[model samples]
Each structure stands twice: as structure tokens, then as C-alpha cells.
Target: MVKVRLWGSLRQAAEGQTEVEVEARTFKELLDRLVETYPGLAPQIARGVSLSLDGVIYREAWFTEIRPESEVVLMPYMTGG
Candidate 1:
């Protein structure tokens, strides 16, 4: 199980728990697990949310694999004009 930390508005979706545990082999899997664990978070977690693994930002496609002991942070998207 990987430990996932929720931030900002996501904390609300996660029932105000700053941290959660998810079973996953990849970052994508983590999202899938999160949604399954907390159905209410699906829509929010899907909107270009970025992930950080062990405190390092992970880019697209980098989510293909995950470390078993990794700690992930889910952050809302940042949009610019």
C-alpha cells in the first residue's frame, strides 16, 4: 500500500483526511484506487491533477510505474492564460 497525501480542496473530498493509503502499481493506478476508495473524488481527481512521488514531481507517462514505498501527493491543476 502506498501512502497518498491529499491537499487543498482534495482534502475535503477525502473526508478531511490529510493522508490516505492506496493499493497501486503506478500513479494512474493510484488515481484509480483513490476514486474507488472515495467515489466522491472522481471528478475532481480527474482534472489534470498532477502527482508527486516521494516529494518529486512526476510528469506524464512517468506514472507508468510506482515504487512500492512511495509517498504520493495529489495537487490540483494550475491553469494559465
Candidate 2:
């Protein structure tokens, strides 16, 4: 199981949960499982989000490998005004 930390709006979508556990081998699979477990997150996820794995941020790394102990964080896309 991977530990996923939800931030900002993503946390709101997940019913205020800051952390969640999911079983997946890859980043893409994690997202799939997340949406499956938390249907409310689908719309926010579809809008676009950034992922941080072991402190490294990724935007389009769907194939990134994720281990059971990996530290993962999910947050809404960041932009500058």
C-alpha cells in the first residue's frame, strides 16, 4: 500500500482526509484506485493535479513506480498569478 497525502482542494474532495492508503504499483494505478475508493475526487482529479513522490513533484509521470513505503502527495495544479 502506498501512502497518499491530499492537499488543498484535493483534501476537500476526499472528505477532509489528509492521508489515504492505496494499493498500486504505478502512479496511474494509484489514481485509478483513489477515484474508485473516493468517487468525490474524480471531478477534482479530472481537472488536473500534481503528484509528489518522495519529495519530487511530477505532473505527467503516469508510469512512475510507487512502492508500498513511498511518500506520495496529491495537490491541485499550482499556478502563478
Candidate 3:
């Protein structure tokens, strides 16, 4: 299981939990598992969310490999002009 830290607004969607664990070997799997476990997060996830592995943030990187011990953070999708 990969432990993901919920950042900012994501904690509320994750049932107020700051951290969560899900079985995932890749970035896509992590998102899938999160929604499956926390239905409240569905809409935001569908709209878009980003994952930070170690220190790098990823958006739409479905195939990115994630280590079980990696520092993972889940947050709202980042946008820039």
C-alpha cells in the first residue's frame, strides 16, 4: 500500500484524513484506489487531481511508477496561465 498525504482541500474529500493508504504500483492506480475508498473524492478526481511522488508533482501521468515508500501527496490539479 502506498501512503498518500492529502493536501489542502483534498483532506475534506478524503473524510478529513490527512493521510491514506492504497494499493498502487503506479500513479493511475493510486487515483483509482482513492476514489474507490472515498466516494466523496470522485468529482474532484474526475475534474482532475495531481500526485506528488517524492517531490515532483504529476498531472495526467497515468503510467508513472510509484514506490511504496515514496513521499506521496494528493492535491487539486495545479493550473497556470
Candidate 4:
């Protein structure tokens, strides 16, 4: 099981719940489950979001390859202007 944590507006969509569990083997799979379970969150995720696994930010697609009991956190992408 993957632990999925949500922040900001995403939290609201999850009924103020901070965490969720998904049956996914990888990050993308986890994301797909999220979109499937929470239809309301789909738009926010589609707009581009950053994900962290077990506290560290996952920057490479490689993170999506390993199947671990992960703690996945989602937040908006940061941009420097």
C-alpha cells in the first residue's frame, strides 16, 4: 500500500484528510489511483504538481520504478520568477 498525503486545495478535496492509501506499485501508478479515487483532484494534478517520497522530493522518473511502501506527498510546483 502507498501512503498519499495531500496539501492545500488538494486536502480539501480529500475532505480535509491529510493522507490516503492506494494500491500502486510506482509513483505514476499511485497518481493514477489518486485521480481515479478522487475525481475532484484530477484537475489540480493535471495542472502540474510536485511529489515527495518519504520526505525527499522525487525529481527523476526513476522514483516511479521502485515499488516501496512509500509516503507520497503532493504539492504545487515551485517556480522562480
Winner by lDDT: 3
Off by over 4 Å in 4: 59-63, 66-68
Steric collisions counted per model: 0, 0, 0, 0
In model 4, what lDDT does residue 10 have? 86
* Residue-by-residue lDDT tens digits, candidate 3, 1-81: 899999988899988999999999998989899999999999999999998889998899999999988999999987798
lDDT of 1: 0.80
TM-score of 4: 0.79
- Who is ahead in TM-score, 1 or 2? 2
lDDT (Cα, 0-100) at 69 in candidate 4? 64
- On the 0 to 100 scale, the lDDT of residue 23 in model 1 is 85
Q: Per-residue lDDT for 1-81 in model 1, tens only?
A: 888888788999888899998889887888888999998789887676778877777656435677777768887776689
lDDT of each: 0.80, 0.90, 0.92, 0.74
Total clashing pairs in model 4: 0
Cα error of candidate 3 at position 14, Å: 1.0
Winner by lDDT between candidate 2 and candidate 1: 2
Which of the predicted structures, 2 or 4, would earn the higher TM-score when compared with the native?
2
Show where candidate 1 strays beyond 4 Å: none
